[model samples]
Target: MKYSLASGLQPPFTQRESFVRSHPDLYWRNKGIAAYEQNRATDAITAFRRAARYADKPSQAMIAQMLWVGDGVPMDRVMGYVWADLAAERGYPAFIATREKFWHELDRDEQRQAVVVGQAVFDEYGDEVAKKREDKALLLARRQITGSRTGHVGALIVSLRLPNGDFETVDGALYYADKYWKPEQYWEWQDSLFEKLPEGKVEVGPLQMPPKR
Candidate 1:
């Protein structure tokens, strides 16, 4: 079964549990959605609030919306604005409009209060989003460069034994590794290996090149 918050339909309990077990960050958000659909506002609020602590964008958006409508929590537009702003900052497209709506509707005093609250939220969660994104990028980069020496020094040139029982020359790169260097001969040595390469069975494939400075 599938779950779509927009559709207001929750996935099977077992599936949701399994999903949450593997991705604990999603636990509160998914639980909140299920609770909301079941008309359990208090439970939904609790779940959504917990999710927000983990920087769950949709949960932040939902808490903002719920606060705006006084669905489960007391109607507090300032709090709503704070969460909406947080959600929007997280790049949750659905909450972008909600954040703008809150901004345009709130008065100066309310906006000021929201700014304080939003700043607190930012201070608490900003690094969480950034770290999550960085982790994802590293994971993706590793997958993309799997089985191949994508990043290497000196133009990433590589020698490999071809299937035809012949050695072939190729280009490669170092896999997002750190490099330290200085001008060996006034830019003549464009590439230098400051770090030792890991020992392992190297895969021979596509030619990769060092990034141009």
Candidate 2:
């Protein structure tokens, strides 16, 4: 389900801020898309990198595309392959295909370089590290909303705006549905937001490569 604020009801600014903070992967990914569409390649890359830190697969793919063609950053096919491989970790078919394509495009030297750079990338942005970062953010967001470390404070009523304009008033302990509270569920939900790409089509495919200076 698409997690968004109520359409009709305007939530407090702080509440909206808290919501964005809780799901930074989504925020930065969307921000990257906007910047990219506006031709702000540098800003888009920066935003996508931040999103990748939270395990945003699409953002990871986008970063790989930009880095591959030197759109905003220097061309580094090795690092591009590394990011593509990272994006493919969860076995998404599109991402997996893209990763393979990147590998096939590389020479033996670049492949070796990719393996080395991949280790460093994984140490920082792999699911093991990235998921923990997002989990901590979610935990902190829940604490702020429920005002309790355990996400419970007896009879605390938390009203959440549902997609259909209805408000679901739930206990503080249950305020965040599994999709928002549980890291795995949250990742799945976010994954669902990705549109299915055509076979052999990378969603963030490279444009024409810029001429070398």
Residue 169 Cα positional deviation in candidate 1, in Å, after optimal superposition: 42
- Candidate 1 per-residue C-alpha lDDT over 76-167 given as tens digits, one digit per residue, 9 for 90 to 100: 99988887787666333345556777788999999888877777777765545533543443344443444344422445544555445766
Q: Model 1 segments beyond 4 Å from truth?
A: 1-16, 127-213
Q: What's the lDDT for residue 150 in model 2?
A: 75
RMSD of candidate 1 to the truth, in angstroms, is: 18.6
In candidate 2, clashing pairs total 0
Worst 10 residues of 1 by lDDT: 186-195
RMSD of each: 18.6, 7.5
Top model number, TM-score = 2
Per-candidate TM equals 0.53, 0.71
Misplaced by over 4 Å in model 2 are 1-18, 152-175, 191-213
Worst 10 residues of 2 by lDDT: 1-10
What TM-score quantifies how close candidate 1 is to the native fold? 0.53
- Global lDDT of each model? 0.54, 0.72
lDDT of 2 at 207: 26
